[model samples]
Target chain A: MLVRVKSRYRPVAMTAAEAMDGRVRRRERNAALLYDAAAELLATRSLDEISVEEICRRAGVGRATFFRIFETKEGLLREFNRRLTADAAARIDAAGDIDLRAALGHVRDAIIEAWGHAGPGHASMALTYAYHAPERIHDPHPELYALVRQRIERAMASGEIPGVVPASLAASLAVINLTAPVAWTLSHRADELDELSGVLLDQWYAGMISTPKPDRRRNGPRP
Target chain B: MLVRVKSRYRPVAMTAAEAMDGRVRRRERNAALLYDAAAELLATRSLDEISVEEICRRAGVGRATFFRIFETKEGLLREFNRRLTADAAARIDAAGDIDLRAALGHVRDAIIEAWGHAGPGHASMALTYAYHAPERIHDPHPELYALVRQRIERAMASGEIPGVVPASLAASLAVINLTAPVAWTLSHRADELDELSGVLLDQWYAGMISTPKPDRRRNGPRP
Candidate 1:
């Protein structure tokens, strides 16, 4: 009788733990959905105007479910920003092996793809977040920046480039080259991206690696 | 008596016309003030939540004057956008010089200076418009892009650069190089505009003019 009681208690405890784990997993999934819905809603409407109930309705989750997942709307936004930065970092990591030019192209394409996949509302929200919460993205990720600096340093050392452009400057230029197209495209100038990319690459290569032209026509008398 | 009456009426009519012109000019000035105030206020508050009365009060103008100048808030926004674009274009033109690279450097400096002068609120609005209004800046001014293209073509024809790279590509690259730093700066990254300009110039010279180094080692049926 004692053995049977102990076995029953063990099964009950295991079932309760499993049920709790399932609930936590379910909560996390719902929270992600709500965050995504909030981002979409924010694109078209002001953040203050978007209510928790509206998010719950759009996410197909209950109000209790949302409250259980996040403390507030601002909390959800914070999480969204965190996720976006993480996704960008992951994309950069995936593009590790490619040359600077090709890696930049990949970054641009990935951002564009994400924008396309998002609804208009979500895209607008993303833009607002990018503009307003720049600190979130701007905060230096040492690991990412280090990787960028190392790549530039390697390129310079390999004789693919000449002169001593600072690694920090090179990394900044690389990022600028990668990001400008997306900014331009968002402004309804999608046609310019290809042309702009080509121009950027050409100028970057010319400035970094090309030799100076001879000064045949000197201002003063030539010896 | 009839002649005296006619002369008097002429002076009165002229005075009325002058008064009308004065009112128009004052109205225009007030509108500009209101727009500036609205942009400033938007930095702290949501655009939808800010009232016309508050904008007028902040501008030191009256409600009637505000309505007289702008039929609606959206009308004021459109005018503000137009004025800002024109201002940026003028600044870009003012930065022009005989040397293409120097002129480009001036253009970049002008934009950075303007952003500094405009403060965060107005600068943010200008950036948002640039990102949203492609048609406004697209048809590149003949005096700008065309001039750049000609200069690059001249350099190419003279063999200032060793190999043939497309002239159009060269011109576009120059513009993109000038712009990338500004875009990166917008993200509030730690990149100095002057350093970016120098790095761009260095890369352009190296990539376009220098000869490629020959591969040092080759093994083909050596034994």
Candidate 2:
């Protein structure tokens, strides 16, 4: 669990636990400052236009400090994305012992709320991730995938989503279909970003992916 | 109908009809030469590394002539994509009032065959199209969508795939899912490009794109 921080640093000597706590708080505060600065800068300018020095200066943090927190500028966006997924994962976990459909509703609602605030910064982040390393279908955003995998496994145990298809593909399929709008916003339909993700997510939750291992033969044996 | 040309031009004076024929032939030849040269160079070099002058030089065509033939290098790619869609559309049309699933099988086979020979040129072409202008979910690959729309209408006419969903959405869904591999080739799973498209297409063929309206209420009124 991340301990949210309030202040940057204190020079006075203290107990080892107190010192570690101060370090954690300072680290988190710096990360939060850098993220806010990046978002503010990216609101009016493209990623290429914003320099690291500007972000550091705006955050009131040293350049070396910024580097210590994030390996690259994109690391900030990735960390933010990780938080969003973690939030949704927690919700999915909280839905324990409930129906699968209701659990997926949490996933859909999480996306809707997230994209509601998405600006050019978010769009650029998504594009960078896509171009640098496309999400692997087998495993992507591992923690969230792991949680969703467990959910699917439970569904399969109950035979809700058809136990025939492997739980792995089902989870990946569900995750990718649900998350497609992030990458899609970089396209011409960007204007429809907020609305489209909602629609796609709704459609996904409404019906399961075609999991029935229907006559795969008539398709002529996978070319 | 496209008149495939064998050679560039012959300047001998001829009748008006012959002159028109020569112009069409020369125009097509120029476009083909540029496409082939672009593909050959792209095989070894990234798109950013190659220049228009180099492409023209390799094609033995002048820069002015290249510009006349293609609005932009990306335009050449768009045309190639157009050709691929045209070929698929032709096959779909020739299916001529056949069963819907069987016709869809023709669409799947067409994608598999095309991707088998896809190279970096095809991958770059897909990315350019994806970034510049996304295919509208309402209408994509116009010629192919039109034909598939008609086919879906015919199926609905016979109540085959069920007439609940609009033929327009169904056709668009089919086209987008079918062509997903072209854009997907840019991802890390690119090695599976040829194989994955085959599977997705088969899944699509085996089942419809969730045409059933199903209980949308349980998903919480679309966020």
Per-model i-RMS: 17.8, 18.3
On TM-score, the candidate that comes out on top is 2
Query: What lDDT does each candidate get?
Result: 0.46, 0.51
The 10 consecutive residues of candidate 1 chain B with the worst lDDT sum are B1-10
Per-model TM-score of chain B = 0.39, 0.49
Give the proportion of true interface contacts each model preserves, from 0 to 1: 0.15, 0.01
**CA shift of B73, model 2, Å:** 6.9
Off by over 4 Å in 2: A1-26, A36-58, A63-76, A97-104, A117-223, B1-25, B36-60, B63-79, B97-105, B117-223
Task: Output the lDDT of residue A60, model 1.
Answer: 95
Q: What is the lDDT of candidate 2?
A: 0.51
Distance (Å) between predicted and true CA of B65, model 1? 5.3
lDDT of 2 by residue, A80-188 (tens): 5445444445555666643322332343333333433555655565455532222333222344445456656766676555554445554555445433443354333
Best by lDDT: 2
